[model samples]
Target chain A: MSGFDVGGRLKQLRMQRDLSQRELAKRAGVTNSTISLIEQNSVSPSVSSLKKILDALPVTISEFFAGEEVSREQVFYRASELTEIGDGVLSWRLIGARRPNRRMSILHERYPPGADTGEDMLEHDGEEGGVIISGTIELTVNGEVQLLTAGDAYYFDSRLPHRFRNVSDSECIIVSANNPPSFSDGGDAQHHA
Target chain B: MSGFDVGGRLKQLRMQRDLSQRELAKRAGVTNSTISLIEQNSVSPSVSSLKKILDALPVTISEFFAGEEVSREQVFYRASELTEIGDGVLSWRLIGARRPNRRMSILHERYPPGADTGEDMLEHDGEEGGVIISGTIELTVNGEVQLLTAGDAYYFDSRLPHRFRNVSDSECIIVSANNPPSFSDGGDAQHHA
Candidate 1:
C-alpha cells in the first residue's frame, strides 16, 4: 500500500515485460509524466488508478503482492512469506522468494470453499502435473472432466484449455508444476495439479 | 547401499519407464528370474551388476539417491532433505517438493572442481533457466560454451544437447529447474527433500 513498495513492484513488473514508460502509459491511457512520476515514487497511485493500470497491463492484483514474508531457515520458505494471489476464494502463494539463483518458480495454490478457476477449459504450451495434498477439485480437460481427490495425480500437455473448481465446501490444496516455468501471471498457465 | 532401498528404487524406476520385469531383464543382460528376485527383495546384486543394469536404462547413480532424506516440516521440505547428485563433483537437490501442486519444480545443484557432465550435450523439449549461486560452471549449448559465475543466468531449450562442467577445484552450486521436472536419475522419489 505504500507508494514506494507499489512503485518498486510496478517497476519490476514493467521491466520483466520489457515495457517502456511511454508504451505502458499509452496502453494504460495515462500521461507519460504520470507514469514516470508514479514509477519514481514521486506520486502514489490511488487503488482504482492502480487497478486500471494493472488491468491494462493485464497483471492480476494478487500477483502484484506475491513476494513478501521470507522464511527464516534461510533454506526453507516459511508459509508467511508466501504471497497470496487471486481472490480469497482462489488464491496462490509464490514459495521461496528469498531463494537466490532459482531455476524454477514454485507456487502454492488454494481453492476456497466452492471456488473454481473458471467454467471454460484452458490449454497452453507446457507440461503440467501435480499431486492433490487435500480437499477435492474437479478438473475438465478436452471433453472429459475428472474429480480428483487427495493422492490422485494428473499430467497433461498444457496446450489444451481446462477448467477447475472446488466441489467440496472446504478448501482444496493442490501441488502443481509446469514445465518451461513461466513465473508470471498470464493466460499461458493452466490451473490443475 | 542397503539391499532393500536399491530393490525398491529399481522397481519404481522400471514402473516409470513402463517396463515389465522380463523386458527389463532382457535389456539388462540378466535373467528374468534375477530381475524378479532383485525386485522382490530376495537377493541383492553386486555393485557391478547393478551398474550394468542402470547403464542399460541410461540413468545415472545420482538420480537413485536424490530423494533419500525426509522433511521435518508438516508440509515444508527442509534444506537438509536435499541429496547431492552426480559423483562427488556435480550435485543437485529438490526445492519444489513442499507442495507438489505448483506449476514449477526448483532444484539446487553443485559441481565439483574440474567436474563436468561429460562431453556429450543434451537438449530437452522444455524451457530452462537458473541463477548461479556459487563458484563457476562452464555451460556448453550446441557448440557454444559460456562460463557463468555467481548471479548470472541463462535460459534455453532442452533440445540443445547441452553439458555443464566445473573447471575449478572448488565446488559450484546452482539452482535449476526443467519443465516437466525430469528426474535425471530416474523416478526414485528418494524423499531426500
Candidate 2:
C-alpha cells in the first residue's frame, strides 16, 4: 500500500462521477477541507476514513486497493494480450482484467465437443449472460435445460446453479458477460469432457 | 408501461443483490407487505413508490424502464448480431447492446490507414480503454501524443478529450471498452481520413 496514490485515485474517482470535492465530501460525510487535503496528498487518511469516502463512490476496499494494479495494466489487449485459462477441453480468454473496479466480465470462451462443467453444478454470484457465436451448447440452469445453437443466447441468475456442456461434435464459441466479473475464480472449473 | 412486469423485475432486482424481501423493504423504508404486493402483481405501484424501491438497488429509472426492452432482445449476436456504424473510414462493431443496464461498451473497431477521429477532439463521460490488436495507430490524449503498436494499450479518463488516428500504411484492429456503454450514441463522427 506504500506509494499508493490514494489522493490521485480519489480525485479520479470523484471526477469520474462528475462530483465536486464539496459534493463528494458531503456524500462521504467528510468535510470539504478533508477532501481538498486528501486530494492534495497532505495527509494519510485512516483506513476507516478512506472507506467512508470510498463507500460513497460505492467502490469496495478490495477494488480500491486493486486500483494500483489497474494502473500497471495495459490499456488494450489483442488476441495475444488476453489472459488465457484452459482445462484442455475449454479455453477462456479474459479481456480487460486489469481495468480498475471492472464492473463487467467479458470473455471469449470456447468449448470443444463433449466438454461439460464437471459433475457438479456451477454456482456463483451475479448474473451470467452470453451469445453463442458458433456451434451448439447444452445449458442447464436450476434443473431446466436446453440445447442452444448458433445465434442462441441465455441470461440467468448465476445463483440458481448452472452447467455448460458441448454435447455435440463441434466447437462452440461464446461471447459471455458476467456482471461484477466472476473470472479465474471458482467459475472456471475442471470440466468433465 | 402497460404490460410491464414490474413485479418480476422488482423481484429480480431484489434477488440480484441477494437481499430478502424483508431486508429490501427495510432499505426502501416500506413495509414488507408492500414489496410482497408489488412483487405478486396485486397492485400497481406509484411512480414515486417504485422509485423508492428501485433506489435501494441503486439503479436508475431509465435502466429499470429499459429492462423490458432487454428481455425482448436476443442473448447472442454473430457478426450480423452487432450494431454497426461507421463513415467508410472506420468500422465499429458494438457487442451486447441488448443487455440490461449495460455497464460496459465492448467494440471490435477497425481503423483504415489515414483514418482519424475527426478534427474536433472527442470527449465523453466515463473512461475509455482499448488495446491495439493489430497495426499501428497514433493516439492523442489531452495533447499528449504517442504511437501504439500491437499489444500496446491505453486507458484514460474520457473526460480528457482524446483522438485516434491511423497514420500507418495498413489497417488497425482494436478492442475498445467504454464504461457505461456509450454506443451508437454520438461517439461516431464524420472522421476525416
Candidate 3:
C-alpha cells in the first residue's frame, strides 16, 4: 500500500469483474498490449489512460486505490494513522487508509514557506474545497489570484487551472477535501490529463 | 448555525451575490413567490426547488448550509460540537459546521433497533456513501435490498430511491458522507420533489 501497486490492483479489479485483458482493453479503448504492459507493471499508465481503464470497470479512482479487501468494522481513524503522501515542502495527511469505498478524499495538508505547486499549475476532474487552517496561501484558479488567510475557505471546480503557494514566510496548513479523489501528485500537470 | 436557517441563509447568499429575489427566481426557473416564501421562512422548499435556487447561485447545498460567516481558523471539531439534526430513533452527528464553503457533509449516524427511515423511499440529487460502523442494517436502493453489517459500506447516486432500516436488535452506527449535502429531514419524501 505504500507504493502505488497500480498493476496489482488493476489486475485484481479486472479479475474481480471477470474481464479478460483483451476485453478490458476493448472496453477501455486501449490496445491489448497497453493493458498487458500495465498489468505486468512494465509501463506506467498516464492519468488519462488509467482513468479510461477505471471508467471501463465502472469503478472510481478512489475505489481503485482503496484496494479489494476493506475492513467493515473500522470506523474512526486516529491522526497518527493517516496516510502521508506528497514530498518536499508539501505534505498531505490522508484519512481512512485501507478503508473501502471512499467518495471523498479528506486531507490535512501543509506547505512550508515559499513552497509552490510548480509553474505548470494543476487540473483535474471533480470539485475541490478547503478551509485555510493557518497561515496564508496564494491560490490561483484559472488565472484569478486570491490571497487566502487562515479561516478563509475556497470551493472551485478542479477542471480549472489552479495552483497553490505559501506566499507568507510561514508554514501554511489547509484542511482540504475533494470529491471523487484526484489521485495525482500535484507537481505534474500531465497527471490531470 | 445550530438549526437549518435555510431562509436566512438563502437571503444572505442572494444578497451577497447582488441578486434580487426576482432575478434569482428567473434564473432558478421558479416563481418569484416561491423564492419569497422560501426566504420569508413561510414555506419549506422542496429539494428540487432548493437545488434550483442554489444552482442559480451556483453553490452546492453543502456550501449553502455552511452558513454565511464561516471562520477559516476553525479546522477541528470535537465530538460534542457535532450538530445533531435528526430526531426520534435516528441521530446524525454532522462534522465541520463552523467551517465555511463545504462540499461534503460527513455524518456519524445512529439508528436504534427496529428504526427505519419510513415507508416512503428517499431520493435526491448527488451521491452518497457510508460505512456501517456497528450493528446491522438493511438498505433498499431502487428496489434492490442489501443487508449490510459492520464494516460494510454503500455508495450510490442519491437520486436512486433508497431507504435504510436497522433490522437487528442492537443499535446501528454508520459513518456516512454525501456530496452536495441533502438538507431535508429524511422522513419527508415530499421534500425531494
Candidate 4:
C-alpha cells in the first residue's frame, strides 16, 4: 500500500498523457501487445522493459520506484482493538500498539472509583501528560495534590513520586501519553508496597 | 504546580502518621508554635527547618524534594483550544502546541472538497501516519493510489512523491501524527509547483 502497482501506474500515467496503448507501444518501440500484457499485470516487466517504458513516458526510474518496495504500516485502530496495558484498578488502552519504533505512547485511560495508585506505590519516572476527558481525579505529584476535573490538565517530569485517585463515584477518563514508554518493562525502580 | 504545597503536604503527612502539631514539634525538638506557623504557611520554612520537620516524620529530604524545583508543564488540552496550523485547503488542529520539548506532533486534519496537494507538489520526506475519521481521500503515494474512507488508515515514508485529493464531495477528516513536524518552514524542498 505504500507504493504503486507498476503496471496500473503505467496505465494511469499514459492516460494522463493522452496516449493510447498502441501509441505508447510505438513511442517505447515495444510490441503493441506488450502494453496490453503489462497493464493487465499478466506479466512482470524486466528492468530494461521498465526503463524503456518509463523513458517513453519521460519519467525517472527513481521517481517511479521511490517507495515501491516499501509496504504500508498499519495505521488505524478501532477502540475494541486497542491493546490493554497494566492490570491495576485503572485501565490503560494503548494506541498503535503494533506501530514499529514509536517514540511515544498514547493511551486512553480509565480510573474507576476506589482507584488509588498511591497505596500501590507506582512511580513512573518519565515525562507524563494527559487531558481529563471526564470526571475528576486527585493527582499528587511530588506530594502536591491537585484536584483536576474535565478540561483541566497538568504536565510534569516524573522523577517525583506521583499517584492518582478518583474520589468521585464516576469513572474518570483521560487521554494520556508518556515519553520513552514507561509501562512496558514494569518500571525502572520497581517495588510493590 | 509540579510540587507539593509545603504547608499542605506537611499537614497531610503529619495527619497520615497520626501526629498532632505538638506531638510533631516534641518529636523534632522544635517549639510547638513553629509547627503551627509553618503549617499555616505563615512563614516559609528554612532548609534546616525543613530537615527538622521531615526528620520528625521520618521522611528523607530527597524524597520530599525529588521534583520540587521542576515546574509543571501544561498537561491538558481542550478540544476548543488546539492551535490551528497551515492555511491550505485543509485544516490542521495541532494538539499541545504549548508543550515544551515535544517529541511528536498530533493533528486533527480536515480536507474539504477540491482540496488537493498534488498539483502543488508538496512532498515532505518524513514518516507520516493517520487514521481517516470521515468521508474519503484519494491518496496517491509514489504513483500507488488508494481511496481511504472512515476507519481505514495508512502509514508511509514520505520520501515517495505523495499527494492527497478529496475526491468525494463531502469533507474528509483524519487524526494524524508526524515526527519532527514537516509542515514548518514550508517543507524541506520548497517549490511552489
- Using lDDT as the measure, the top candidate is 2
Question: Candidate 1: which stretches are off by over 4 Å?
Answer: A1-75, A96-103, A185-193, B1-193
**Number of the top DockQ candidate:** 2
- Which scores higher on DockQ, 3 or 4? 4
Candidate with top TM-score is 2
Model 3, span A1-193: residue lDDT tens: 1145668878977886789999999998988899898888777665456667877875544445432332242334444555677576588766553444444666667889998888898976556666565788888887778888765566666667789988889999766667656543343313321
Who is ahead in DockQ, 2 or 4? 2
Better of 1 and 2 by DockQ: 2
Per-residue accuracy of model 4 over B1-193 as CA lDDT, tens digit each: 1124667767866886789999999988788898898777676664456657777775544334322344456544556676776577777766666654444456667789977875644565345556565799888776777888865566556555678889999999766655434444233513211
For model 3, state the Cα shift of residue A133 in Å.
22
The runs of at least 3 residues in candidate 2 whose Cα sits more than 4 Å from the true structure, single-residue gaps closed, are A1-93, A98-100, A108-193, B11-28, B32-37, B40-84, B94-106, B126-131, B141-146, B152-160, B177-181, B185-193
Regarding TM-score, does 1 or 4 come out ahead?
A: 4
**Per-residue lDDT over A67-182 for candidate 4, one digit per residue giving the tens place of the 0 to 100 score:** 33344555445556667765678777766656544434666677998777756445543455665667999887776678888755555665557788899999997666554344
lDDT of 1 by residue, B14-98 (tens): 8767788888888878778877877776765643455456656644333343333332212223345443454554566654444
What does candidate 1 score on TM? 0.34
TM for every model, in the order presented, reads: 0.34, 0.50, 0.38, 0.44
For model 2 chain B, the run of ten residues with the poorest summed lDDT:
B184-193
Give candidate 4's whole-model lDDT. 0.63
Local error of candidate 2 at residue A130 (angstroms): 8.9
In model 3, where do residues sit more than 4 Å from their true spots? A1-177, A184-193, B1-73, B98-100, B184-193
